[model samples]
Target: MKSELYYNQDRKRRLFVDLWKEQTPFVDNENWTPPPLGSRFHFYVSSRQELKKTFGGWRTNETNYGFNNLSYDYGYYNSNPIPLQPNNDTFKFRLSSYNVNGVYGPIIIDMGTIETLNFAFFSGSGNINSGGVPSTPAFSINYYTP
Candidate 1:
């Protein structure tokens, strides 16, 4: 396989924009959109919002919604999904791995070399079982690979 390692330092790039929460089960019909990719990126998720519906009415809380106010200490959340460019007018594999830290500039890579690229956000165990109200604190990513 022929490929370049580092990113392109010439083309200007844009980093992460904002963080968002992923609806559980991934089938709730709730979807999120992430910003474009560049060179450097970084995402930290601390807290999230949990929308609930009690007997009285409906409400939203930050107990363990699924990635609300992300922080660097708790863990790192991608915040956005990296989109891969098209190849010969056709979309190829997915690009994940670099966090919000790798979307600041053009990450020039040798085209038609690698098969695929993938990335994911990682959260530590510090806020996994805090036992708040939502029962779980998770960081999620919403993206389109086409």
Candidate 2:
């Protein structure tokens, strides 16, 4: 998923992302180790001064983290509380995960400084196909800046 920033002057910001699994079957069944279904999942956030920076000093928002199982029809939702400052203007936010796939967005914020937002997800080792017939999963992101 792409990292996004809020462009408002609000002091407090809330970031949220919804994720789910699509019932897509793995092509190479013989050589694939399916990821654990309905397993505990975690998320983290990273901040960067420049868009092209290699290391953006990643950090985990323990307050807004939770366990999610994407295989289910009802997707998982996670939110992080962010405090914005006037000095800390013009920064990018990146979203990452473990044992998760089919990510949707960074839900743009109406307030604060945000630019060059990117979306990403993990699809190898620990990502398993959903049980039963293939189906399309859902994912979304929302934020509160006030």
Candidate 3:
């Protein structure tokens, strides 16, 4: 997924990653393949950071879920939306294992406008033909900025 930024004054920000995955099948063949189903999941911001410059910098929002003990249920992650403060008008984003594994994004995003309402970025992964595998999934982000 591509990193995006909004153009507005600072206010408040909260983020959640919704992941719909296809469980990879055991079978592998040139002519036939199985699709990953029943894997529509979301990670409600388990851990976040003002920056990923160091391991000590990260703050864990929820103790029950982490990279070690991953849960398929939505109740494991944090759902309560509290306005998050960005550091230096910048948000250090790293989506790890979103999991059996979570998604760790190795991307940096400049904090966008806060006042502008409705629609920032929307991304959907996987397809009917089983496009994305477990290791590397395929997704695209629809970006809009006012």
Alpha-carbon local distance difference test for all models: 0.26, 0.25, 0.24
Q: Using TM-score, rank the candidates from best to worst.
A: 1, 3, 2
Q: What is the lDDT of residue 7 in candidate 2?
A: 18
Question: What would the TM-score be for candidate 3 when compared with the true structure?
Answer: 0.19
Better of 1 and 3 by TM-score: 1
> What is the C-alpha lDDT profile of model 3 across 1-146, one tens digit per residue?
24222111221222222332222223333443444222222122222211222346533221111222122211111122223222232222233342322334322222222211122232333210100111222233332222
- Per-residue accuracy of model 1 over 1-146 as CA lDDT, tens digit each: 11111111331211111232322221224453642232222332222222334566645322311222322211222333344322332222222222222121222221122111232322222111111232332333333322
* lDDT of candidate 3 at residue 120, scale 0 to 100: 26
Q: Give the CA lDDT, 0 to 100, for residue 6 in model 2.
A: 24
Quote each prediction's TM-score: 0.22, 0.16, 0.19
Candidate 3: Cα lDDT at 92: 23
Winner on lDDT between 2 and 3 is: 2
Error of 2 at 11 (Å): 23
lDDT tens digits by residue: candidate 2, 1-146: 32333211231323333233223222333543554233322233222111111245422222222222322111222222233222322223232332222322222211112121121222211111111111212333333223
Which regions of candidate 2 deviate over 4 angstroms?
A: 5-36, 51-140, 143-146
Candidate 2, residue 25: lDDT:
25
